[model samples]
Target chain A: MTSDATPALDPAVADRLKRDGNGLVAAIIQQHDTREVLMLGWMDDEALRRTLTEGRVTFWSRSRGEYWRKGDTSGNVQHVKGVALDCDGDALLVQVDQVGAACHTGSRTCFDGRDLPIVTDQSVTTDGDPAALEGDARG
Target chain B: MTSDATPALDPAVADRLKRDGNGLVAAIIQQHDTREVLMLGWMDDEALRRTLTEGRVTFWSRSRGEYWRKGDTSGNVQHVKGVALDCDGDALLVQVDQVGAACHTGSRTCFDGRDLPIVTDQSVTTDGDPAALEGDARG
Candidate 1:
């Protein structure tokens, strides 16, 4: 495993990254075909480099303080389909072709069945006009 | 503008969150209809509560050290369609009906055109069989 002192990623790519104080960026993994968000993980330059070149998703485990390649132990591999960096360069969007469950709980995706109930604004019109609210004071 | 000392989120939902040392979680925003990832933001309990209860998305600006509601200035509102917590509760997936550009750069998405060149493993079969690699030593 490469240390944070030495970045394995291309200098051009590494220079754009805005890592957190811990020298890590959040990686959001999504299913390429279904477009389902599979999971979220942390990655440093090396882990991002490995995922891009090695064709499999790799993440730096914050709790374990080590690097881990997805599906290495569980056989639920995430094959790289595409990778993109967000505008601010603080996050990554990793599109992959998932082989099996993407969650440790055996769910197809990490966000599956984990919805948090929220009050949807009924005032917003179907055309997505918030100003269309009927007599709403919050306007 | 609620302080971190007093959480505004539902107790049940707040209890599940595994926030970072700074008491923040990564929020991944996606377009509801297109399923396109719009952007990524940080949220503390108060921001999460405002996003859930209010019609629009609210995020805590790490740099500005304040709360901001999406579309307040840019008119690129993100009306909440759904919100979910990742399995580990360290991240959030916020589905919304985006009104305009989601990127500060005026792009449709924060990840728009920011693709990284990576070596895709052509050896992996179409059926997603990693073992189907022919004469590949990395198997």
Candidate 2:
């Protein structure tokens, strides 16, 4: 739970993010040890700057139009371990030491709860591979 | 594989995605069976529509500013099996039966070949329990 500035991020690397149109890029949060993805958030220049300068994960809330640091309200803080820029530079893989539940609904991930329903439309009907379409497309 | 117009996605579900700022949402691609995150792409309304209608994953390329379908040129096609909308409606979890390497570098995922460098900053130092930091932030 180190809160000092300078986590596992390279300032030069963060600058390479493509934040052109909306001054934002998608930050994918993953659990440091398990590599399980917790959640995704949008980060602006200031948000990335703060995240690098301040260790704790900070995100640009689109709905609120403000900078919200993780764990400011909930104890679910994400202490960054390392930050990796995707080859495309448009997305980010943020490896973090997460604490508590990552989802606001008390789930471990934002992807839980909802089961992806299979569409019986042409796309699925065309594929007769019954084995590949399990567990929300698990094969 | 079913290359016809149908894929494993529901159009109505995609319609629920919120496309306010920049008219785009972060589309996170995940491997159907392996659960490995392949890549992240941006999807506008048109992109989402095409993905649902056509069955192949289509993304809005920010740099090129065009609708690019997966595997169109690279041969790395993401045959979508399922699509999930985040509770906030700002992000998407796209499960796909991917073909070939998802990354341009011939890697299975865009996050490969990088070790998450650890930082001795306050964030890591505050938490002394190494046991709790297992399972990608799991105790």
Mark the 10 consecutive residues where model 2 chain B has the least summed lDDT: B130-139
Compute the lDDT of residue A5 as modeled in candidate 1.
86
- Candidates' chain B TM-scores in the order shown: 0.80, 0.74
lDDT by residue for model 2 (B102-130), tens: 88888888867543333333333112343
TM-score of chain A of 2: 0.75
lDDT digits (tens) for residues A15-68 of candidate 1? 999999899999999887678888999999999988877878889998999999
DockQ-based CAPRI category assigned to the predicted complex of candidate 2 = acceptable
| Each model's lDDT | 0.81, 0.69
Write model 2 residue lDDT over A96-131, tens digit each, in one string. 788899999888888765434444343342233444
The collision pairs in model 1 are none
Cand. 1: chain B TM-score: 0.80
